[model samples]
Target: MSKKRYILSVALIILTLNPIFSQNSPKTEILLVGFDHLGQMDNGTPSSDIFSPKKQKEIIKLTEKLRTFSPDQIMVEKEPSEQKQVDSLYKAYRENTLKLSEIEYGSSETYQIGFRLAKMLNLETVYGIDHYESTSQSLLSSGKNIDIFKNGLLELMNTARPMKKKVQQDSLSIYDYIKTINQPKFIDLSHNLIFNLPAYVINGKFSENGTNTVDIGKIDEKYIGAEYITLFYNRNLKIYSNILNAQLDHNSKRIFLIMGQLHIGVLKDLLEANPNYKIITTSEYLN
Candidate 1:
């Protein structure tokens, strides 16, 4: 009788601990791809000058690998309007609106890659953010120059701005960063790549004369680099939280988010939110 009781007690203890442990540990596979650029159009081929063809091929191969898990949903960094445009096309599979062949150069690559994967896997893609048109329309209504703002942002990212490294105490949260930077007024801040560089560049190239570092006036590269790094760290925290919440809200079993490398850096925070999913990357499963 004592022996039976001991086994029963152990079983009870495990049952109790299981729930707690399960809550603390979740498993979700997050495959993060760092694309060459975030331009508005959809390009079939990635720029070898910017990111190598080898890397681009690897990304596609990784996309194929994702099919094995069979993701039910995909979240993109594009605005709602753009997302809708693509979603509509995918639903119809063909429309006069835009041809898959029409997508070329920098802007087109994102859609091509995303839709290709979606079609191959038959997953629903969700444009997880507010529409750019809504934001642009609001800005226009306020008599703000949307063109200037857009141009400024494009210039900031493309022009060689020297980034320096330094720890900043400001809130690292994406919401806080956007608020602190007053990003609504700045159109460029809307995109993830411009805002989240630190997380994406895993093997960060030392750029003394790169377009990304063009804006540092007289300030040493160290400070500029630090500012850029801080920006991404905070942005990643905010975005990861958003993605986690979205996944929970939708009650999705498998979700694959294609964002910059930087945002996907916070895997632990992401896993904590969705504690029942397995977290893996293209690199991990592929090579």
Candidate 2:
């Protein structure tokens, strides 16, 4: 009834609604689904290709379930060199969404699981990993110090060359990816392959498994055992930290990360630390 009373009441109402408004605002949710390798089967055991009939069907089913979360954005680990290729593949798929099932795996070497998922969900996708295509060229071109990478690659090539049976002309530096990752076993494997048979090491750029080869200096026969053991356990935690930092900054309501099982150990640790996120496994979706 009184002017002062009315003003005070209005102020209270505004304060109450502010929190609600803020809560409803758009935010980012990042889902990372890491597979062992683009495998031949749903078990993720080196499927022929992500778009294989079986793989597509499984992905369709998975998408149907992931759609329940209504993710705002999807991100996949794609190399920059592959972006144009991915775009072309996506263009072809978008042009022929109907025949996607019948298309062969090689139809578009660029398209993978994330591309199809984004297409099915009609969501935006991003290539998160900072990979360079001509890392050697880039290193040579860099104005800043390049020895870290240049020398690293040279040393890696020299040490690993002996091991490689036949080297491919087109190879990229995996040190960038490997350095970002902190897995002991992966490092050990890289070390072993680089030192023992460098030529066969290819590009040293396997997804999370460290199956690919990038040159690293000789592995100390004695230290190899300890170094790998340490890396195996440590890699997951480091990756978890990177993922957390990337995801928490967004306004995503439900985020899924597809990563290797080895990374699961790290995710477990993260879920324990952050109470806000509700971690659900693929099996949980089955139920």
Best by TM-score: 1
- Candidate 1 lDDT over 1-287, as tens digits, reads 69999999988778658843454544445544443233421133333221344434544664565567676767666654465675676665433355554554323334545666777876665545311211111111111233443454465445312210000111122122212222222222334333443233232223443333223334333333334444345545556656666666666666766654333435434564655666654444333
Q: How badly does each model clash, as a count of residue pairs?
A: 40, 33
RMSD of 2: 14.1
- Compute the lDDT for candidate 1: 0.45
Q: What lDDT does the true structure give each of the candidates?
A: 0.45, 0.42
Q: What is the lDDT of residue 268 in candidate 1?
A: 35
- Output the TM-score of candidate 1: 0.46
